[model samples]
Target: MKSSIVLGLGFGDEGKGVVTDWLCRQAQRPLVVRFSGGHQAGHTVVDGAGRSHVFSNFGAGTLAGAATFWSSYCTFHPVGVANEHRALVDLGLAPVLYVAGLAAVTTPYDLLYNRVLEANQRHGSCGLGFGATVARHAGPHKLHVMDLFDDFVLEQKLGSVAAYYRQLGVSFAEEVLEQQLEDFYRAVDYCRTAIHCTCGRAHFKNAADHYDSLIFEGSQGLLLDQEFGYFPHVTRAHVSSRNALEMIREYGLPEPQVFYVTRAYQTRHGNGPLTLEHLAPQLHPTPYETNVHNPWQGEQRRSLLDLNQLRYALSADAQYAAGLARQLVVTCLDQLDGPWWVSDDDRRTTLDTVSELAHRLGGHWQNCYGNYGQAGNLVAG
Candidate 1:
């Protein structure tokens, strides 16, 4: 019953996909369980076969033939899953996905409402309706993964949410709303067959017994946590190990080793308080990188390494993580040119080694890595 959790220490895009893929390769076909966030996730992985994928709704380890389980906390998007499934098939891989009945489902109305709200508020959304879905469910208008199978209940929820948005002064043309509703119903029908929708915790408990290992895959990052992240720039979901640990306990699985990942340089996708990001010099883009300027989230933001803030995140996570052993994984060492430096007041000091940075952060990790060049080859601690 060996299980491990892969979490992003910084903002999203901390190479969680590659780390998950690497962990899968380390084991004999472990199950990858998504515990939080949803379709807005952009975890990129380049496989041994040179095929690349940016996982959204699917678990990152699917590239390595790992089965996926979407727990109750994950905000699922059916259309995103359908699209990502095709991409996986094209790359010569078949994915096995299991969805918990309690997982939240994002609807077409959620997407439209998110776009309209972000257009006015500029909260730096991924425009994937993650926030809107969370907000909608907080009210009486709710949609769950299980509701997708019951057409009558699903339609009622959709209609209720549409009316709720209308009450909020969102004016969707009758024709447009009808078309989107039609599309949503069609997607639900397709996904019912496309995905494995299981009921309750026993399925996962059985999986816990059956699999050699389980990789609790977290999306987004710790710094963007809804409760702890810089307000206004934070995600609407719990982006840390909070949900994963709860699932682990409920299933009576062995405590998982926590693997914290970050880039050699600090990178933030959307608007957020990135310490000294604007002051630092930007590195030339990685050749295999998939994240770029997009209309929804704007440009990719980068900054110098800030270990002090990184330490703060570790400490914050410690409150929830409790007894789990922490491991550090610093990725994209290939992109770091010359000696690495951490910001000191207005001055910069050369970071002699990764070990020195680890010391400054004030913790002895169970394992430390400087992952560079490729995915499979790991830099020894």
Candidate 2:
């Protein structure tokens, strides 16, 4: 009955993978539950042995021998799954994956449309068709994980999806479309053999009987939630604890221990408003940095940690997280040159240590963890 939820307190890159990896090691058998977002997530984990991986299609705890469950709120990409499955197998790890039968499925057409749309509008898309896939499901055309195993239904839905995008001014050569379709079918076949498609709700209700613990892994961050974020630039999913809490309730689980993670500083990718971005000193990029400049997501921007913004995000999540035990995890302590640089309104303050910062944070946390490198330790009381 031991379960916990890991959420990013800011715009991603919050070391969620690192925290989840540590949590997985603590449990005898852990099931990583993905409740929001999809393959667009790029949670990176570095083992003590320095073995590193940027998890996308699979949960961050894959290398820790934890099984992953893609909930109904997530989107499934057959191609992405197939590629990641091969990569993990090559690493000598057999990844166990389960997908909700009703989870939205991403198709080649969605990827094409997403790329074209981002090129025209530049709304900071991840260029993985995650938002487009969710949008398509909301419309007349739809595809699901279970549909992939059915040729007739998959074809009908995929054709409509292609036509729908074509009407939206996204065009591709017939030969290119045919090749993409061929590749997609092959990917689906590969995924069919590797994935276990099941009813998300039913599986969750009985998950505790099969697994010793559950680790609910959230995607993106609270600020990027579709309902709370600053529109346009926001992700198409609720990145908060809302979805996770609902699932817990439906499964008749106990109040989960919630770990809200953030870096020693603030960061954002693509395009959006980031407080103190221009005022803070530009940090020299670390050699082990996972986020880099790209055409789709632009540059990964950083700034001094804004205490006000952190409070705001926590307050927003508090509504959905009432009665749950909460913890604070501040990562990248090694990146700080001296004390913690924090921004509050027009004034900048420095905290001499993580303990001081946690006290200044002024919230009731069951525990606080400070992460300097790959691992996290409890802040000295």
Candidate 3:
């Protein structure tokens, strides 16, 4: 079976969604697998017809008639799924999602607590209970997709999760908690009609044999990984190819065709140490920009590409990426109106084209694709 993995090399918003959509549209029958992160993912995809969708619960390939398989490492939010399902329906697309039974379930309490925590800590959260859900799963009070099917089990687990949050000093008013529970159950009812649960690894194995191609769409970026990224500013999930590689090996799939994606420049959302923050104004804007200034994630930051950090990320993933056919995808090329500005250690270089940028970074990648504007338009270099 042909397997492809799309990863963001820098701090996200690197056009991974459009890249995944491109891969799906090219494949005969593609199954998009979410191997990490959760409902907090904001992968924006704009179709060739100018139809735009910022996929959170659904895979980025959903717009291309591709089925999504949410892996066990990911989290599931029933309310978010219900809302995104309706949104996709409104856009004239039938989204088919199969969530793993062992996937962690996020609740409204987790949502509220996440916002409260981010308000004080300001750790660049999407404020969608992604980290909170993962944190809750580690504790005694846990909820999973399997429990969502049984109402009695779901309610009991949710109550325990609420008490666990309360012990962490997060409290909610009686009516507030009641309303949150009401909306949660209502969303759960809608989700039951929309989503389907699977037997985790077994189902994934079947999918690998059934579909002609499997596109593993990863969330965030390599720099935001819980282990590799800077502390306190990193995400709770494994944004690297580690989780995806593990799943591929367990399922006995062939070596994956890994596509490491990044923008022509650098961009980061929320609070973090951006390499060249002053060069933000020098970059041009794209037509399908999805990230906006929000109270939760704050402003979407920008800078020139840091080749040093890109090399660091490549080294970090090198151990797990052995024997994998890898390529580089540089997106947002249309945003670069002038010379390609890239920094390497103490020195900087001004390259004329994407190929020049690739050459300066060494011979790690033999093939590179540059994306111009939105709509998943890619040109191989």
Candidate 4:
């Protein structure tokens, strides 16, 4: 049996859920594990029956009968997870899911802090409390889902967080703080009996001994990785295959094929570098629900893939491909109207206008995939 990881190569909303679901249908009873980020991620899965499910905290396989495990790096938003569970049930999907015993819990304090931080500055954050929660954990007191049952300890942790925020000139009314704490406690209590899990070891054991394959799904993109991505603007997780490889190595599992999914026409969510203006008119944006102020901005045009940027991402993947090997899967090929680039008598015009902008941004375009297919199967030029 092999364990694989499928990750995005862009700034996220890269259709990873669709890719994961596609891979799940090919493998037998695969165990899907999420290694990084949390409710800040948005994954939409359209099943074989043509029904679509939008997920935030839940895994892509919840509709496919595959069990999902949330690693310790992920944050647990009990209310969000519970609400997603109900939506799944309403759609006639099973709510059987698992979360690491020690996953960090996103409290109301974290949410409030996130709102305050975003309002005060411009980090292009999703305002999901991800960064704020991480900041809280890095402080003296660390609280996880397991700590929720211990009211005394939870209160202490909240107090410490409150005091820390207060010192920073951020104010929180005492009644509001108390109410949030109480709500957080209740949410944790509900999730503890429902989806909490300590299955990292056992889940891996089953995948290694029983299942034919396992797929690790990553959130965010290589460009948004905390280490390799654009500094200070990236997500606070390792959105690369390395995290998946580490998990498989810990479980002594066989190496699985790694697939890097990219779109024919590039797209990015939130505020970041994008070549959207040069894209085709048909690639216009569609309405999407997100925390971003201008969710409809990117939808107005298609984003062109910066060959140099793609090369950078590929180079990173190549480094991680040492053990399991890797391949590139380009999606949404139909979105591009012509060849990668169109040349005039004197100047060269890229099929994606964004590519041209990236060129002006001092990005070189030598390594663009000369030939590729809509289904992601590559053809040698």
Q: lDDT values of the candidates?
A: 0.82, 0.85, 0.85, 0.67
Residue range 1-381, candidate 1, lDDT tens digits:
688999998888888888888888888859998988888988888787787788888888888889898887878888888878878888888788889887888988888888888777876789889998998888888889998898798878778877888789887667976787777777777788889998547676577456888999998888999987888988988878888888888878888899888887788877767888765644555786777887777898888878777887898888889678888888887776677766754467777556666776787677787777545655766
Q: Is candidate 1 or candidate 3 better by TM-score?
A: 3
Candidate no. 2 TM-score: 0.95
> Candidate 2's residue-wise lDDT over 57-135, tens digit each?
8899988899999998999989889999999898888999989999999988888778878988888789989989999
Judge candidate 4 at residue 365 and give its lDDT. 31
In Å, residue 297's CA in model 4 sits off its true spot by 9.6
Give a tens-digit lDDT track for model 3, residues 315-362. Answer: 777768866777888888787777777777746677676677677777
lDDT score of residue 145 within candidate 3 = 90
The estimated TM-scores of all candidates read 0.95, 0.95, 0.96, 0.82
Misplaced by over 4 Å in model 3 are none
Which portions of model 2 show Cα errors greater than 4 Å? 173-176, 281-285, 375-381
**Clashing residue pairs found in predicted model 1:** none
Better of 2 and 4 by lDDT: 2
Q: What is the number of residue pairs that collide in model 3?
A: 0
Model 4: how far residue 265 lies from native, Å: 1.3
